[model samples]
Target: MSAEIRLPGLPLVALPGVYTPQDDTRLLLRALEREGVRAGSTVLDLGSGTGALAVAAARYGAQVTAVDIAWPAVLSTRLNAWLCRRRVRVHRGDLATALDGRTFDVLVTNPPYVPAPGSRPARAAARAWDAGRDGRLHIDRICDAAPRALRPGGVLLMVHSALCGTPATLARLTSAGLRATAIDRTAVPLGPVLRSRYAWLRREGLLSPAQETEELVIIRAEQR
Candidate 1:
């Protein structure tokens, strides 16, 4: 496991209540570059926290759209897009309905994967990371929608903690008819949020007493 490091590219501004870009975000960016967004391609950034990924894709010549349920995140993403001089269509809505009839060539996401003690995260900043008890709330939904959200042969790049279950994610995506596999991964120390729930996570058998780092995996799934 190595220390968490943020990859450099564009500057982003996260509004007070918005989730700031982190390691998972930077990792997703790397994956996006590897996939090579074609100029004029359609890209969607689900749960675009600080718009880092969306702006990056736009800079790569993709027409990007970003969605986040939180208003602050929406504002933060719009602000970042403006600052970066990239045009990204941003929307504020729940994941299920955000892109009602939309499909894209590439879908990039870093959804919340923190296994929380609650059945659901309360509104506000907690929604940024507090996925349900098993931490697959958002991830599962994303997988289910991947098929309909992508164009034929489109690519889906997602980043999340291994704490939630990488195999499960790959399985779900494959079951949905996408060819999916983990493309990149790294282990980094748990941050303050996970540290705060250290006891609960240990008791839930999701973490070990000596485990201080969580593995983050970037999964790449292609629509056939």
Candidate 2:
């Protein structure tokens, strides 16, 4: 199946400072659905914003665990999971070190992939979307950890903008010993965040002079 599964209306609540689910979020959810999370599957929702994907996975009978570094996100995920009547184990910690001894059948992440001129923000709302200059800070960490975080025959689902370099992500995952490829792609109008940084992106050659839309892709990686 294609990675373009439609997302359902999830009863999610995002607190102030927590990221509200947007295009990337919806795309990740669509990929998760297309993967067909099996009943009682062990699933990890890395960088869970509103825990929308976690809750959806739980609805499909997957045992979901969500991790985020921000307090607002941690509480928001818990609140939303409760609101949706789903059981999700939510943890708050740095993404790089969280879940040190854990692995799951499926790992899904839609991390901070926006290319930023400055370092990744700490304790700011921007932390939800801003990555470092190359926008591969969290993406790299996720790729490094995926091989160990996923059990054999497990799957990793990730979504990000083409501006961040889709081929790079696929190559990284492959080097980490997983078979990976883009499963779905769609173009979206630049959002407020991208629009705000249009000049910087253009200057850095991350975006073209006249480009106003960004392509988003869902990458699926399978463990050998």
Candidate 3:
């Protein structure tokens, strides 16, 4: 089962399963509009939960491919594409594996980035929020793979936690051969649930107490 969500003039269908769109989807949508991603450009969406970004790109007439590791996400993406009457290729696999031998002019992703404590191993879709020990595991992998996935002069847009591992993300992107820079940032208040979870991490020395404030970073990089 899925639900249809209308974002202003944009209509999107969300999966009833584990995958759902996050605020990062809005950030990417705005960035694409600003950067003028349109027809003919090929866009690859990694960790494409619910297919919002892919559908938006397709709506703009761009060729879009939405990839995820979860089968439910793949099904939802396909359903959403059908509802929109657009052709979006949905692949199910881990990271870049589904995109074998394929490249894109624009690559966008919003990966798992929450730094979970060792005691609390993630379960289900919550795993999508856990980024391993440093909260950069998934992000680093994405950055490392972007060079091969993106064409020369192509663009990569990603949203990650600035408080958790922004510096690490920048370093990883640079080391991965992409000239990365933060383009937009927004501070979102940590809900009580997250605050309590983060408090536990702080007490365990996994996160700094000063990290009570969470910042969302939108990074744009170009393959050089």
How accurate locally is residue 43 in candidate 1, as Cα lDDT from 0 to 100?
97
Models, CA RMSD each: 3.7, 4.6, 2.2
- Which pairs of residues clash in candidate 2, taking residues 3 or more apart in a chain or in different chains? none
Indicate whether candidate 2 or candidate 3 has the larger lDDT: 2
Worst 10 residues of 1 by lDDT: 1-10
Candidate 2's error at 50, in angstroms? 0.6
Clashing pairs in 1: none
Each model's total of backbone clashes? 0, 0, 0
Report the number of the highest-lDDT candidate.
1
TM-score each candidate. 0.95, 0.94, 0.90
The best-first sequence of candidates by lDDT reads: 1, 2, 3
| Candidate 2 structure quality by residue, lDDT tens digits, 1-224 | 11112347676677888888878888888888889898989999988878889999999999999999888889888988898899999999865555688889999998888888865364488898888888888899888888988899999999899999999999999999999999999999999989999999999999998998999999999999
- Order the candidates by TM-score, highest first: 1, 2, 3
TM-score of the candidate numbered 1? 0.95
Model 2 lDDT, full chain set: 0.87
> Candidate 2: misplaced stretches above 4 Å?
1-7, 120-123
